[model samples]
Target chain A: MKYFLYGGCSLEAGGKNYMVSLEPVCKALGMEFEEIEDWNCCGASISYAGANELSIMTLNARNIAIAESTGGYDIVAPCSSCYIQLVKTNHELKEDAELRNKINVILKEGNLNFKGSLNVRHLMDVLYNDGGIDKIKSTAVRPLKGLKVAGYVGCQTVRPYGEYDSVERPKVHDLLLKAIGADPVPFPKKMQCCGSGIFLTELDRCLGLVKEILDDAIANGAQLISTVCPMCALNLEMYQDKVNAKFGTNFNMPVVYLTQLMAVAFGMDLKKEAALDYCVIPPEGIIKAAIGG
Target chain B: MAGNYDPSFAKEVFDNVDSGEEIKMCMQCGICAGSCPLRHEMDYPPRQIFTLIRAGRRDEVMNSKAIKLCTSCYRCKVRCPRGIPVIDVMHGLAHYGIKKGIIPRKGTAAFGGEFWKMIYNIGRIDEKTLPLKYNLLEGLVPGIKSTIEMAPMGIQMFLHHRMKLLPERKIKGIKELRKMLDKAKEMGKGGAN
Candidate 1:
C-alpha cells in the first residue's frame, strides 16, 4: 500500500490537519506513503473557472509528470479538488492525443513530460477499496458508540469518475460509518453541492446553499457530518456562524474529515496537538462521550 | 422584448462558447435550476438562461449577473436530464462576459484577479495575504473595514496556527512555472481545445 502523496495548496494551507491525521492512520493500516517534491497548486475550482481549460490542465499535468518522474508511483491526493484536477489531467491526457501533445510541449519547458502512466486515486477511495473495510473494522475496538453521522460526498470526486462508489447514491461512506459502529444517518441531499468557491463572490447565495445541507443534516439527527472533501468540511464547519447569522437558523453541526474519524474509531493514538479548535461545533463532547469520558 | 432580442445570438453561442452546442439539447426540464444551490439568487435560472439563449437575448444573458454567479458546483450537470454540461456553459458565459467587458457582479472578477496574481507570483495561495489584497481591491477604507470585521476569524485562524506573519515562498523553479503558464495562456486564448 505504498503510494506517493500529492498535497495541493489546500492541504499545504487550510487542510494541514488532514495530512496530520492521515499519516498515522495510513501507517496504522500498513499504508506507506511519501509527499511528492515541488508540486504546485492544482488550480482548484478557482483556476478552472478563471483560467482556460488548457492552463488548468497544464497545471495538473505538470504535477502528474513530477510524480511520473519519481518512478511513477500511484498518486494519492487527499483533497477532492486536487484529486479531481490530477485525475482529470490523466483522463484527458489519455483520451486526447492532441491535448497530450500540447501539454507535453508545455511540460518540456519545465524539463518534464506527462506520460499519464501514474494511477491517481483519492485517499478516500484508497482507504475503502485498497485498505479494506473489514481490516478497518477489526481495529475499530472503540466505536463512535451511536454517534449519528451524515456522509457527504461532494461533486467532483464522485462524478466523471465513479471509481470507488456511485456518483448519485454513494453508500461507501455509509458503510464506513457502520464499520466504525456509528449510526449512518440518511441525508436526502447527500449528492448536493456545498456551494464552495462562491463564498466570496456571492455570500448570501453561498450561505443559503450551506444552510440547506446543514439544516438537512440537523433535521436527520446527524450529530456530526463525515466528509471526504476538505473544501466541503471547511465550508460546512467554518461558515455555520455566518450562515446562522444570515438565515437565523440554530444549526450547529460539527463537520469531521472521514480520515479523522477513522483514526478515532480505530483507537489509534491521536496526539492532542493534532486536535484542531477551529471546528465551530467541536466534536470533543461527542468524541469524549463516544470514547467514554 | 422581441425588438431587443438579437436573432443571431444563439447561433453565435454555438459558434463561440465551448460546449454551448449542448445547450440545444436542454429540454427545459428546469432540473438544472431546481438542483442549483444558487437558484434563488439567479434571475433567470439555468433553464430560463437556455430559453434566453435560444430566444436571442444575447445582451440580456451576457449582461445578467447569473453567468458570473455560478459556483461551478456541477449539481446541475450531474442531474440534468439532457446531459448539458451546466458548469462549462456557466463558465463559458462568464469568460465571454468578462471578455465583452460585462461584469455584472462585483468583487468576483477582482478577487479572481488577486487570486491569479498570488498563484502566479507564488506557487500557492497564502491565506494571510489573499484577503488583504481582495479587500484592498475595493479601496483602503472598505478594505480595512472588511478586514476589521473579519478580525475575529483571523484571530481564530491564528490561534489555530493556520497562518504565519510571513507569506508562502515561491516554489523551486518558479521561472519555469511562469514560462509554462505564459505558454498556457497563449494556448488558452480559446477554452478547452
Candidate 2:
C-alpha cells in the first residue's frame, strides 16, 4: 500500500528522526511512504487560534489539496497538531459548504482546491488501523516485553472534535503498546495537555501542568512515557529538571517519540533509533531492557 | 474558606461564553465525575458544575469546592463522551473567582497564586523557594526527615548542571505581561459585577 508521509513543521525544521524512522517502519511492513512534495506548515496552533474561518482551516485545507493532488488517498501526519488540524478541516469542509466556499476562495490565490477527497490519519491511526497490530507484532525483531509505558496522547491528537478517537478516553496508544509487546499502564492523565506551545511564556503553568500529568503517570506505575508529538516529547523530556525542582518531586519519566519506541521494539539498533540525543531523560537503559542486550 | 457568595456571577460567565459542547448533551453516565480524582471530595462534581453553570448559578458555582479542587488534569475533559470542554469552562470559572478574590485558596490553586506572585515580582522562579511555597500553600510542611531525604537528589541535580542557581535570562516584556494580567483582572471583575 502507498501512503503519503506528511510531517508538518516539526519534520521541516530538521527534527527528521521521527519521519526517518517512520519511513523504514512503513517500508518494512510492506507499505510505501511517498513523501509529499513541497509541503509547507499546516498553520498549526496559531492559524487556528487567529481565524477559525479562513486562516487556519484554509491553510490546512491546502495541504489536503496537495495530498489529493498526489492522488494518495491516505495522508499520514506524524505531528499531532497537524494531524488534528488536517482531520478537523477535512471533517468541517465535508459537512459545511459555506466553510468550503470561504476556504476555497482563500486557496484560490495558490490555485489549490480542497474537496476533502483524501483521508487524514495520524501515524498512530495508520499503524494501528491500516497496518494492523498483528503486522507490527510479526515485524518485531525485539519485543518490548516487561516495559511499562505511559501512552501520552497529548492534546490535539485526541481532543476537541474526536476526529481520530475519543479525546478523554483514547485507546490508540494502548493498542500500539500491546502491539509492541509492552504493557500500557492505565493513567488518568493520558490525554492531558503537555503545555506544548504555551511553554515559552507560561513556564510555571506549563511545569505545573506537566508535573501533574507525569506525577499521575508515575503514580500509576509507568516507567516511560511515549508521545506522538515532537513538541510533547521536547516539553516532557527537556523540562524534567525544572518540573522536578518546582514540584519537589522525583519524576524520572523518560519521554520518547512513539516511532522511537517502535524502532526499539522492531529490534533496531539503539544508536540508529536515535535514543541518545533526547533533551529530557536518557533512554539508553530502557532501550537495553527492551532489546535484552 | 468562608467568602461572600454571589450566585449570578457564575451564571453570567457561563451565559456569556460559547458553551462549546451543549451541557444538556451530557448523558450523566458519570464517566467524567467518576474519573476525576477530586470528585469524591467535591460537593459538586464536574457534571453538577456543568448543570449549575448552564443554570446560571454564577455565585454558588464560583464558591463551590469543585472549582477549588480541580487539578486541571484534563481527566474530565478526556473522559466525557459528550466531548464537553470541562477543563476550559472550569478554569474560566476558577480564573473569574480567583481574580475577584472570591474563592478561598486550596491545593494547587493556592500554590499557583503564590507561584505567579513570585514570578511577576522577581521576573523569575527560584527553585529553592518552590518547596516552601508548595508546602505552605498546600498547608503541610515536609518534616525534617523528608527534607533530609530529598537533599541528595537536589544536590545531584545542581551538581549535574541541570538546576540553575539563577534564571538563564530575566524575563523580557514585563510591561506586556503586566498589561495582560491587568486585562485578565479587569475581565474577572467585570464578570463578577
Candidate 3:
C-alpha cells in the first residue's frame, strides 16, 4: 500500500528519530510513502493562538489540493497535531459547503482548489488498520516476548475523529505491541495529555501532568513507554528531570516511538532504522535485555 | 471583578468565536473540568467558564487563565455528555481574546505568535530559530536568561541531533502559500492577523 506522507514541522527537527524509524517499519510492512509536494505547515501551532477556523482550513486546503493534483493517495500524517488539523479540515470542508467555498476562494489565490477527496490518517492508524496484526507478527524476525511497555497514544492520535479505535480508551496501539510479542501493561493514563506545546509555556503545570503519566506507567511495570506522537514522546521523555526536580521524585523512564520498538522486533539496524541514539533517555539496555540483542 | 456583566458579550461570543454557539448545549456537567489536566492551574474550569460567558461576565471570562490553559487534549470534547466541542470553544475563546487584545498568558501568546510568524514566512517551522525568536520576544535580557535556563536540555537535544544548527530552507511553493495566507487574512472577519 502507498500513501502520501505529511511530515509536518516537528518531524524535520525534534522528531527526526521518528522519521528515521518510520522508513524501515513501513518497508517491513510493505507500505510505500510518497510525500505531498511543497506541503506547508498544518497550521496546528496557530489554531489556539490567533488563527480563525477559515485561516487553518485554507492552509490545509492548499495541501489537500496539492496532493489531489498529484494522485488519489490518502495522506498519512505522523504527527498527531498535523493529523487532527488535516482530518478536521477535511471533515469540516466536506460537511459545510459555505466553509468549503470560503476555503477554496482563499486557495484560488495560490492557483489551487480544494476538492476534499482525500482521507487523512495518523501513522498509527495506518499501521494498525492497513498493516494488520497478523502481518506485523509475520514481519517480525525477533519477537519481543517479555518486554513490558506502556502504549502512550496521547490526545490527538485517536480523539476528535477516532475511526480506528476507541476515543476514550484506545487499544489499537496496545494490540500492535502485543502482536510483536511485547506485553502492553495496564496503563490507566495511556490516553492522558502530555501538555504538548504547553510544556513550553506553562512549564510547572505541564510537568505535573507528565509526572502523573510516567508514575502510572512505571507503577504498572512499564520498563519503557512506547508513544505514537512526537510531541508526547518529547514531553514524556524530555521532562523527566524537570518533573523530578519539581516533585522531588526521580524518574529515569525511557520513552520511545512505537515504530522503534517495531524496528527492534523486525531485526532492523538499531542505529540506522531505530535511531535509538536520538533518545534523551537511553532505552538500549532494556530493549537489548528483552530481545537478547 | 463582579457586577460588570454585559449581556452583549455572550452574544458576541456566540456569533464570533468558532463553534461558540455550541456552548449553549452545556448542561453544567463538570465532566470537562474533571477531565482537564490543567484544571488546577485554571481560574475557572470549562463548565464555570461557560456559565460565566452566559452570565455576561465578560471581563472575568476574558481575563481568566482557563481558556489559555487548554492544550488541545480533546479529553473534554470526547467525554462531554453534550458533545459541546469544549476544546474548540476554549481555543475559540483564546483566539478571540487575542483579537480583542486580552492576552491571559504572555508565554503562550509569544510562542504562538512566533510559530505562526515562522509558518507564514517560509511555509514551515525552523526548530532552531523558533525558540530563539520566541525567547527574544521579551527583549534581550529575559530572553538570554530563559535561554540560559534551558541550555542544559538544549545541549542534550543538540548532542542527540534532534535539532539542526543550519537554517531551515523555504518550501518551493512558499510564494504561492504566502499569497493564500495573505488572502486568508485579508478576507478575515476576525481571523488571525
Each model's lDDT? 0.78, 0.64, 0.87
Taking every candidate in turn, the Cα RMSD to the unseen true structure, in Å, is 2.4, 9.8, 1.5
Candidate 1's residue-wise lDDT over A1-293, tens digit each?
Answer: 78989877666556666766788778878899877788888777765345666777878888888878887578998888788778878987989998899999988899999887888898878888888889888978888888888888877767656778877788888888888888989898776777776676677777877888888888899889988887887788778889989878887787877777887887865444224354546787887687785
Using lDDT as the yardstick, the better of models 1 and 2 is 1
Q: TM-score (0 to 1) for chain A, all models?
A: 0.95, 0.92, 0.98
Runs of candidate 1 exceeding 4 Å displacement: A270-280, B4-16, B21-29, B189-193
Question: What TM-score would chain B receive for each of the candidates shown?
Answer: 0.89, 0.64, 0.93
lDDT of 2 by residue, A1-293 (tens): 88888776455332445665676677777877776655545544422111122344555676678678778568888887678667777887989897687666656556667777788888887788887888999888787887889988887776556665776578888888888888989887876667654453346667877888888888888888888886676678767777878888877778777777787777766555544443236777876776688
In model 2, which runs have C-alpha deviations exceeding 4 angstroms?
A: A13-15, A47-52, A161-164, A274-280, B1-193
lDDT of 3 by residue, A1-293 (tens): 98999988888888989999998899789899999988888877445584766677787888989999999999999999899888988988989998889888888887888888899999988998898999999988888888999999898999787878899878999999998899999999998889987788889888988999999998999999999888998899988888998999989999999999999899888888999999989999999998887
DockQ of each: 0.53, 0.05, 0.73
Q: Report lDDT (Cα) of residue A260, candidate 1.
A: 77
Better of 1 and 3 by lDDT: 3
TM-score each candidate.
0.93, 0.63, 0.97
